[model samples]
Target: MLRLGNPRRRIGIGLMAMTFVLSIFAGRLIQLQGLDSKVYAAKAAEQRVQEERLPARRGSITDVKGHELALTLEAREIFVDPSEIPDDRRDQVATILAKELNATKQTILAKLADRTSRYQQIAAAADPAAAQRIMAHDLKGVGSKHRYRRDYPGGDLAGTLLGFVGTDGTGLAGLESTYDRLLAGRDGKQIIETGRQGQRIPMTHSTLLAPIEGRDVRLTIDRDVQWAAQKVIADQVEATGSRTGSVIVMDVRTGQVVAMANAPELDLGNWMAAAGADRVNRSVTDVFEPGSTNKVITAAAALESGAVRPETPFTVPDQIRCADQVLKDSHPHPVERLTFSGVVATSSNVGTILATQRIGDEKLHSMLQRFGFGTRPGTGLPGEEAGLLPDWKDWSGSQRCTIAYGQGVSVTALQTASVYQTIANGGVRVTPQVVAGTTGENGAFTASPPAKRTRVISERTAREVSAMLEAAVSEGGTGNLASIDGYRVAGKTGTAMRYDTRCQGYCGYTATFVGFAPADKPRLVVLAVLQDPQEGHYGGEIAAPVFKKVMTFALKSGKIPPTGTRPSPVRIRAGE
Candidate 1:
């Protein structure tokens, strides 16, 4: 209403103000499009293009006959876009996901409430059908992609030996860890342009690199025999109320481990839930005094060194004094004259010490070394221990006497079986192996090279010792229970004092029996051991039965027929 200035001047002032505003807008646009174009463009590209990893297919683990032990199967990875899920329906979406995916509602809700994130993984290795059921609802922001899941078809079968994998697709223990490099192949990747909602951009260039698959690992374990051994040993462990138990079955001819079983075995599918102690493969890892099972080594050494013959007579009494220690038989006995074979058959500690004295300490130590004692079995298993065997020069006064009766020396279950394997294979000690070989990308099956073999004793001495072992399992022998029907069994019993690390001294007894079938012609050797058994402490009472059961199964399954030839009776008593 109040008119003040000239009309032309007022109009010019308004025009200048509008021109300045337009100039500023133009300058800003030029700065964005030309001066800082690369920076802006890069920001935009980063927001649109996403790089994702394409996982490689892990290898399969098979037993000797191509039976699948562990393998990988296709699955789905379920994910959600938290940014796209409606705030009002977040709880409802989380509930639905929890129902279909078997996930906790709280966990799903936590992931869904993260509106700041564009993508959140809901579940990995989800069942493909379950994923499909989830996608059927056509729930916005929810999707699934292809993935792979490790499958243990046998569940706990050979779990300790085969090992398990981790969530990040790496082997965590056992053979899976041992062969990780060969089992875990190279992973690939893909870079694709995406939309604001993470949808693939149509007609946009994408880069992809395919993954390389891993090789298949073939093992020397026989599936059927392994199952039998595991069942038998597990039953025995339960019956004996022992702390733990182990069994090893090896082919004397090839030194191939047919079955290595442990009680309270690890469950491959649920390895994360198992106790640490149960996860160990005790057959190769745990060491214990060989007890009477070690007597055969003494007999072999004495015979090999020409210090004694199988029939050489010794006056064995209830006890004998050596190195300030009174070595005695397991039980009190009257003084009696018996052959060396008779002493072994009776498991007489006094008789064994007398025989060891003849060969002296050095020869016995050398023979133990040659028989794979004091050294690792070299079976390619993880956590293998070289059983303790003190040098003869380092042996204490009592150690020399106790060692002759299997008290001072420590050996693993596998090593004990290998010792018998040497005797069964005509004194040729072959290195034991679990892995047969690997199947490469070309699919050609290549066998592992022959196991290293060494001559521990002469064939004649081995035969003589074999005869003595046979007598040890006969009617008057300590391991008579180990004799199988229709198969002449040859084995020895061990009930050595257990050295407990927890108690820091001897705490309990280790019951063990190692032997082979078809005594006249040894084919397969089986060793069974029980640690800290509460039911009975005697090897013949607790361990011999386990040996019989496992050996019977192995013999039948292997299609090994007993030799028709009769076992020639070896004199176990002086008069007889």
Candidate 2:
């Protein structure tokens, strides 16, 4: 104490300085250990572990006959850590991958030579078969991740109807888009250990999460029937020099759309680049004036409302005055007296107009609505259009009369087919079923319950209308070619004039034939429409044979035996 004059002061100052130093050190410790612990730990973990994505398998789509229409196959995606390859072996690895993965050699070499990158995509959606060949060589810096690639077994058969998926395994159109959620399963993940050199550690313990495979989709489409319908429609369109065509084979009893086919189809493999015009599901999406095919609806309305009977006679004329406009038959001839049934059999525009005059527009529109017109068929397909049925209030005098003969109203091909189905099913308008149901991983299927049916007309009226349609396909009738040799056929011929886009006048024509086979004991109802045939414009000539071809296939495919009854003779005289 004597040696240092301010010993107490020196001790007090030293203690205070030590306390300040300790306080600063404590603050730094708290900041690093408590406040930023997670941040540092995350940084360390990110560097130590490698994240790999595990893709899930998409579901399969099969036909009603269990034929595989679409499915997903195990595919391999080649990825690489460029730094792991020896300089001399880079070219060798690239060559092997190029040959197996259908990739350019130069592209694969560039990825292999980049020593700075730890990850690079060499090939995506590679075929498992080819990937196996590559892995057999055991090349360095190369690895594969399993994924699912979409496969269409029925190539271009029902291409437009099945639709396709995107690069990331997402559905883009048709039934794929309609039920994508059910088909795309959940993805999994993997966490792997890595060395300080930024390379995966060999035999290191890692965490993994399992993936869930997607559920399957079962469609009502019959592969055999769909193939036959497509071939028949395609051949007919080419033979008639028509622009395009579609055919729908529906079960009258269940409204199950067995086969829906369209021509001018787009490519299913690369749908994104396909022509927009040809990509439509035309059977359910394209609308057109149904021509005389709609006359059956008018017949039902007349019979149900007691406006006329099948035997009721009307004066037949080549042309009749409908308000200020004159309506004429497709083929010009002298006026022939025909009964109401005869009017339908010949598809007489004047007779149909006269019949509509008795029922009036209000009654006629009600009947059309009841027969599943002016609305979508609820088939769960993408881009479906509810056919245009203008309100009676908006209908002009000409519109009212023209609609009776299947003009002034538009209908999609499905709606047109359903109208015949309604009459064929004893006047019960059963909603068409398309999707059927979805099958889960356990193989248990959850069905889409069918929509309730509504009665459109009385059974007696339906029977009379069916008989009238039968007469139309008889000898000397418009759709005579639609008749099978043994089975009784009932259908109508339609050759509606197409409206010019510029509204100048009618230019092109839409030929159509709608009918059902085994009319005595109905089974299948077929509708065929040919748009703007360059050769002939009559539905009887251009469209009826297509119906016959398709109907013959349907009856044979269904194993339906010949119904001995023949089509009733056509009545030419009105008073009979």
Candidate 3:
């Protein structure tokens, strides 16, 4: 009854309720604007402030003496800001940019037509001069960004060993790929303030995350020695018309690789222009039957097992039949008894087999293992192969005899060099190393120490073997071609038939030569391999001469003083 009498009062009460609701809504809005303003503002800034990555420059690679091998330089990438182009002059701008950037007109037009996109790349990497020329045009949409490009100043000298970088500025092969992480730098971030037109405002507050430069790598290679080795090998390969070849030089005392070269080397400046085979470092990758060059291992085995002495007598026959297989010497020799040294000097397959008979399969294989055969050399290079050496359990009747003269067993150039280095270093097997040290951007270097050595033979045995090797380079020996004018050399020549993939049998030959110099105090060990020489295919005719040239230059350039006199047999053993 009271509500029915007071209509005005009811209307006033409803208006009051509506006023209270509006006050509560206004209070909530003020709280949100004042209390949580920073939180909302930060979220909005994150949406508009794009953080861009700034890439750090990769480190440089140098030789042992800090000569640059691989380095990075600043390059440019051309792009276009589609939204910046004026509608009236879009066609003219597209036509000029397409021709200058080597892009099609249709492609450029399409990029300029995309009004929604702010930026579009025309070319990823262009020459600095070309990029500057395009910038001189002063087109509205045209832009350029800085990038890094890899360069090799040494050219093809150490190309196979240093390798090349890929299109993405990442390492792709050889030592480049093996140590990618250490050589590649970190990427940083930049938070920039933008204007109303989506342009970066100059002098605005910018938060930057600094980048870290990569660590520099120093190799054990000598650039001069490397160039000399390459020149020698390339000339030999061309003169002999060989399908492929490799040369390696090592320090006998420290096992440091002074030079490793190969023919058909890829030029890092234009790596893609060459074939894939040219990119391979044959010194550590390609394996072949070492032929008579492997006689060093057999001779060491016999000496270590006491199966034969340097002067021990044995008969050298023209041919010897062993278990369904017939073995023959390079030249037929009269069936006469000769000293063990004479057998090795002449490289008589029959004598090697006879000595193997005394040592048997077990002792011979054990000695081969000691010389770092049938296994990887652990040089820390990519695509390194462990040359095939069948286990003793897998040896067939004739396989044993074949392996004695280096017929069945296979080895890489590095493995062969390591064998000679062991003998040169007084029978201690030291692992070969390619990297010398790694340096930080702060100019501090962490060097790699000398490799650990394991004794494989008595020092007496090493001296006897050294004398026998000297005899091999003497007059009337197979490796006489390896002799130098002023210095005495000790080396062995190898000519083994390669297994023809098409013929399914041994057809073409692989020529090889491995030896040490000075005949008394060996400083360097050199190994050369030629695959399928068109001219005469013997190691003496093809590989030994190349070895002579490289060894002579290495000794002279290293300034190693000559021993002056031929070492007496008594003096050789006395040092041990």
Candidate 4:
């Protein structure tokens, strides 16, 4: 009886199974169409919609006269969607991409073979033309996306000051790093439709959020002057075989840095091409015992205190013993008397010590503070050193005597220039500035105010010191080599043996020259420093010529009229 009923029962069971399947399908349709419509809609939107990042263009950086220094160019990033590639063409696609992207064949194959990953970057920062070529092949999985690249049009000119950006589109050094927030713009996002192959669907519904462009930056550097200074310093460093060198040119009126050049120099476009030392802005960062260049501060202190006059004479000595230390000139001479101006012109350490003795420690320290020593120059650049000026209490007998002639105390090239600038700008101490202004995304520009000046000495004292500085360029003076053909130059040459901490004695020498032009109407202050010269160790021999070349070009570039009376070029005696 069971065998006879089997066929009919099986047919009934099959029909019941078909009904159950149809009922379940209808319930799913109701849920999708009504009960879970909102949730499904959201899921559909998420699948169909693609959010793309829109990066804003970074701002351009220009010189004071609007010459472009750093700018951005449109570029592209090439990538591959591994899942989109057909299995049959995978090897061919991987080979072509590997060669073009400079990637290993194994790397490309591994990326393409990764079924778990939907997208993979093949090459970041590909040039537009190269990216176009790659996209023209129209490989199944390969694609390109728009991006930005930083360009330095000026190349190595002002490279140390302008700095460069990293691969991640972030600033790495210099002004770029200092003003990163202002230069980097906000990134926007947009929702766009995508195809099944992971490519953006053309002309699909898109919700765009516009990105805000970054603000522009204008610097106080003059490209021409910067180039000239860099050239001169580089040439000088090579010629002298100097271990390192730096040059700085600053505007006397506004305290704006006109040119800052260091050798070795770096090319911002290829930062890794140069050594780490070449990337250093020694003018602002490195400090050394300035030698006789610091006599300006001692002279200023004496002048401000009314303790000495330009004509005031001091009992000069060939050697003076302070504590257990014996201080002598570069060469020993008999005890001689000299005027205050003569003291600076000859760079006599004894005379400076005698003058400082009259001004005392407190007055001299106050004057040094006003000259911007022992503190950061406030240049707003990273790694700006405040320089080393030990407190007055830290000054012992030997320290005080040595500091008078620019020994013991340390200062950067910028601080030395500022000291001359203070005298040049009628004894007003102004804060040095590099940035001229910043332009906002809204097309409004905010300019930096004129440097704040505080009167540190009487106008009469500045003029008096100016006259004494002029005397230093006269016949038989240490810095006579700094005099240019058409300009009356006032400056001092400094040669101090660098104290080797490891050796606990003087090792090499740092040669320096600090001066300003057109002694009657000072316009520019230039400071040049050469660290550890091999050929010639004297500041007058190693550093003064560089200053002459730079100051001559800078004065001419500034359109500073010649003084009409040319001082005779002092013939420097070898080993004098």
Total backbone collisions for each predicted model: 0, 0, 0, 2
Rank candidates, TM-score, best first. Answer: 1, 4, 2, 3
lDDT of 1 by residue, 164-249 (tens): 99987899889999999899888889999998767899999999999998889999999999999899989998998999999999
Worst 10 residues of 1 by lDDT: 564-573
- Residues 1-576 of candidate 2 have per-residue lDDT tens digits of 457469889899999999999999999889889999899888988888888788888888888877888899888888888888898888888888899887899988887777889889887789888888988898776788787889887777788888888888898888888888888878889989898655788898788998788888888889999999999999988988888899999998989888999887666766767788787799888889998999998998889888788778888778987678988887798878888888999888988898889988999999888887888988878988998889999998789889998888988999999999989999888899887788867979888787669888899998888888888888868899898888888999999998756668788899999999789888999999998889988999989999999999999999998778665554646765
* Model 3 C-alpha lDDT per residue in residues 188-215, reported as the tens digit of each score: 7788987645688788789999888878
Residue pairs with colliding backbones in model 4 are 375-386, 376-386
For residues 1-576, write the lDDT of model 4, one tens digit per residue: 444668888999999999999999999999999999999999988888998888788898999998989998998888888888889988988887776767788988888998788789887777888788778788987888888899998888888888888887898889999998899888788888887766688888889998888889999999999999999888888988887889999999889999999988888878988887777677888878899888888998898888888777677878888888998888788777788877877888888888888988878888888888888988888789988888888899899788888888888889889888999999998889999999966778889877788887788888877777787877678888888876788888999988767678888899998889887778899989998888889988878888898888888888899767644332222122
RMSD of 1: 1.8
Off by over 4 Å in 4: 1-3, 6-8, 15-46, 86-115, 199-205, 273-277, 442-445, 499-506, 565-576
User: Could you tell me which 10 consecutive residues in candidate 4 have the lowest summed lDDT?
Assistant: 567-576
Best by lDDT: 1
Q: Against the unseen true structure, what C-alpha lDDT does each candidate score?
A: 0.91, 0.87, 0.86, 0.85
Predictions: Cα RMSD each: 1.8, 5.1, 6.0, 3.8
